[model samples]
Target: MIDIHSHILPFMDDGAADYDAALGMAQDALNDGISTVVATPHHANGVYMNPAGEIEESVRVLNAKLQEAGNPLLVLPGQEIRIYGDLLDDLERGQLLSLAGSRYILLEMPSSRVPRSMEETCHELIIQGYVPVIAHPERNAEVAEDPSRLVRLIELGALGQLTAQSVAGTFGSKLQKLSLELCRRQAVHIIASDAHDQLHRPFGLSEAYGVVKRELGSDAFDFFQQNSRKIITNEEVIRANPVQSYNKRHRLFGIFSRKG
Candidate 1:
């Protein structure tokens, strides 16, 4: 399996602080059945800004360690890019990291507020031929309050990726419910372990898949996994399932606690 989001780059960001922790995270990913991981250290996230070039170098070094350790899992160059007006410029200038160096970039909106310019930004990114993968919308407070904003982002041709912990109910019952609701409405395109370590943010994409399997079915599980592979390969992503929209009222219902 391919884990499209992870902060495993050692001493780079809020992920691993050294090589020992990074190796531990890699081992955890392997145990979870993930064979590949995109080392998505936070980029342009103010406090922890990792550049595109640095990300490539980071992958190179980590791969060397993996090879030495005989670890089967592979690390890829990528970033959890923070949004700004200059996205297209940087992308055109070859200053971005995609998952596995594919055309699909993991783009981040502010956790505090869902970007109001998300629609236009995504449309522009698509026009530029780079697929923007919106990171962890289920955890965003604005979108939690009003999922219609997320619905609109999906409509504008951006794909949403849900965090594994969100599905496992790590953030809270509210986020877990929201994450499942996103799946039910087909608002989410992929499920990834946004793992930061072996403890708090453990590598557990399979466990997340289990939750998705129980909530949706084998079909939904395969749909996300298959398309996630396509995204990393730089291939055209087949939606697998038809694009489904949610009723506005359902968004409000999703914000509250889950009875079941």
Candidate 2:
């Protein structure tokens, strides 16, 4: 499986602390049946600033470490860019890196709230021939309150990526419920292990896929896995299931349920 979002690069951000930790994360991912990972460290998020060139080089170094350690897992270049005013300018200046050089780019919104300009930024990115993928919307407080906000962005051509831990109920029951609801509504297009470490934020891709298959069924499982693969290959992502706009009020009264 290909995990499109991860922070496995050493000393880049709040991910792996060192090369040893990075190798450990790679081993964890390999054990989870993930053969490829996009090393998307935080960029322009007020603290760390990893440019395209630096991330490319960091991925190379990480891959070399993995190879030396006889690890078969592959690490690719990416960035979890927090949207800012001059983001388009940075993209034009070749500062931002897409997932594995694909047209799909991983974008991060503020954790607490979805920025007001998010929809417009997504539209602008689409116009520039880039696919904007929002990372971990289930964890965003505003999105959790009103899922329609996410559905609107999806309708505007943005893809939502649900974190594996959220689906596995690692964060909490509430987030797990919301994650499942988003999946049932087809609001999220892919599942990725936004793993930061082996202990706390470990790779849960296989386990989360198990939850998806059992709770949502085999078709949903296949749809998410295929989209992950398509992103790496730069192929057209197929959304076979029709998306449903989420109704927050109805969700509490049997709007979401386990497969019977």
Candidate 3:
């Protein structure tokens, strides 16, 4: 499996703290059958700001250690860029890091809600030649309540990724079911570990795949694996023709709730 988003870079952010922790996280992924892990440290998240160049260096050092340890995991440099106004400019000017120097960029938004300007920002990124992939939209309350709000992004040619834990019901049944719904509708593109540590948020993606396979079948398994591989290769992941969504109830609820 190719983990498109992760915070396993040592001392880069609030992820794996040191080289030991980073290697440990890699081992966790390796044991789970993950071969390539994109070391996506938080960038411009208002607290942990890992610059693109610094992240590249961190990956280089980590790769050396992995080689020395004879671990078969490949680490790549990427950034989980928080949604902000100046994203396109920062990326174009070489201030933002693409996924291992590819056109694919992993994007994260605020937790509670989807930003109003997010759709426009993604469109702008598309215009500027970057694929803006929203990370972990399943955990967003607004998205969970009304998943069709994400359809606008898909219409604009942007892709969506879900947290592996969310699919496993680590958050709750609402989020877990919503994530599967997105996959069923072909709205979700990739599933990533987004691991922080081995205790609370350990790197465990295999079990999540098991859940998906149980609920969604082998096709869903292939979807997550194939699409993640494409993102690693910086290739276009066209949606499996948009399915009919069972979202009319959600649309009505959203409308009635907003009438206050």
Top candidate on TM-score is: 2
- Clashes (candidate 1): 0
Give a tens-digit lDDT track for model 1, residues 1-260. 98899999998888988998999999999998998888899977778768788889988999999899999889988899899877777877777777887878899999889877777888888887778899999988888888878887777778889999899787788888889877766678888998888899887899888877777667678877887788778887754222332325454333221323
- Give a tens-digit lDDT track for model 2, residues 39-58: 99999999999999988998
TM-score pick, better of 2 and 3: 2
Candidate 2: RMSD to truth:
3.5
Ranking by TM-score: 2, 3, 1
User: Model 1: what TM-score?
Assistant: 0.90
Candidate 3 local lDDT, 107-154, one digit each (tens): 888988989999889888888898888899888778878888887787
lDDT of 2: 0.90
Q: Would you list the rank order by lDDT, best first?
A: 2, 3, 1
The candidate, 1 or 2, that scores higher on TM-score is 2
- In candidate 1 the C-alpha lDDT for residue 182 amounts to 79
lDDT of 1: 0.82
- Select the stronger candidate by lDDT from 1 and 2: 2
Query: Could you tell me the lDDT of residue 7 within candidate 1?
Result: 93
Model 1, residue pairs in steric clash: none
